[model samples]
Target: MSDDVYTGGCGCGAVRYQAEGRPVAQLHCQCTHCRMRSGTGHASYLVFAGTEAVTLTGAVRVWSLKGDSGTDKHHAFCPVCGIPLYVTFAASPGITAIHPGSMDAPERFAPGFVTYGLRGLDWDRLDAGLTVFDAGPTG
Candidate 1:
């Protein structure tokens, strides 16, 4: 992973993306929006501090949804396959959260913390270690 370059595409190959550099933080978000969007208990995300670190190509569609912060979040995906690739927020335009599954090496995603634990389902378990927050971590 030290090579710091990765590329991946949507299931239908209609959308592709490339990202450079390592992630600022990797975490599992248990927010309802995350669970529903991922079709699972949570979403694994690799957050990069610089939005420009990632670039996308091909036909991609974006859906805007409100985030916990009360700001619009832009979710990018492949319309053909409906595979979510990344997300950016209106509040934090400098950051980008890329779905680890949308990257070439998903195994490289080593989540260091868990957020939105208040939204976590007891039935869906995750061993995300000690750094856990009830909701979004407070400053």
Candidate 2:
């Protein structure tokens, strides 16, 4: 794997993806949806800035829901093993965010911030040095 390339797949290897270039953002999200889906207090992600640099293979099932901001958030998972892989946002058409745990090299994930801080659980303490946001960051 190249330094600038990231490769990963579902637990069953039924779905796979390759993303080229550096990630735009890396975060740990504590939203209700993330917590429930991840079966944890938070879910970590690497957000690539453009979908054009990403390639996906194999079959996946997607489900969408309105986010807190009222934007449609589509989650893609492997239909065979039911492992969540990535997500696309209606508001950010070109962006793709993948779960760090799904990466072939999860050690590469370096979260820079925490989203939905208000929803974070005290027991699920994260690095205090990381910036925390009450909601998603906006330009």
Candidate 3:
């Protein structure tokens, strides 16, 4: 991992976080749930280790939802700002999916891949060079 540290927070500054080392991967997810949650063409995320890597400040509200795979996914966001920050899967505790847009400098990490390609909108086109996955790579 690169030595760079990435810092980010919620829109209202109610929640802040700093992650050391470069992200393992950045993703653009076009899944239906992501579209609804982000209210955009796709949701951009940065993946990182869950343990001893993400240092967070302030309180965040969590909401659990059943994923397409029939597993529970806990999404954490700032209660004050209501900005989605991170997501954790019940089946995988070692990884965290962070919304890149919540970061202080989202442009520092461009999405490296696109997921749930089958669900992508017909009008949107992600970068052609990035790898495309039909579903979540976790499964």
TM-score of each: 0.91, 0.96, 0.91
Instruction: Score residue 12 of candidate 3 by CA lDDT.
Output: 90
Stretches of candidate 1 exceeding 4 Å from the true structure: 128-130, 137-139
Candidate order, TM-score descending = 2, 1, 3
Candidate 3 lands at a TM-score of 0.91
Better of 2 and 3 by lDDT: 2
Report model 1's TM-score to 2 decimal places: 0.91
Off by over 4 Å in 2: none
Top of the candidates by lDDT: 2
> Once model 3 is optimally superposed onto the true structure by TM-score, how far is the C-alpha of residue 78 displaced, in angstroms?
0.7
Model 3 lDDT on a 0 to 1 scale: 0.83
- The 10 consecutive residues of candidate 3 with the worst lDDT sum are 1-10
**Which residue pairs show backbone clashes in model 3?**
none
lDDT tens readout by residue for model 1, 1-139: 4568767778888888888887888899988898998899999888877757888889788999887656788999898999999998888888888898988778888899898888899887898464878886431
Model 3: residues >4 Å from true position, as ranges? 1-3
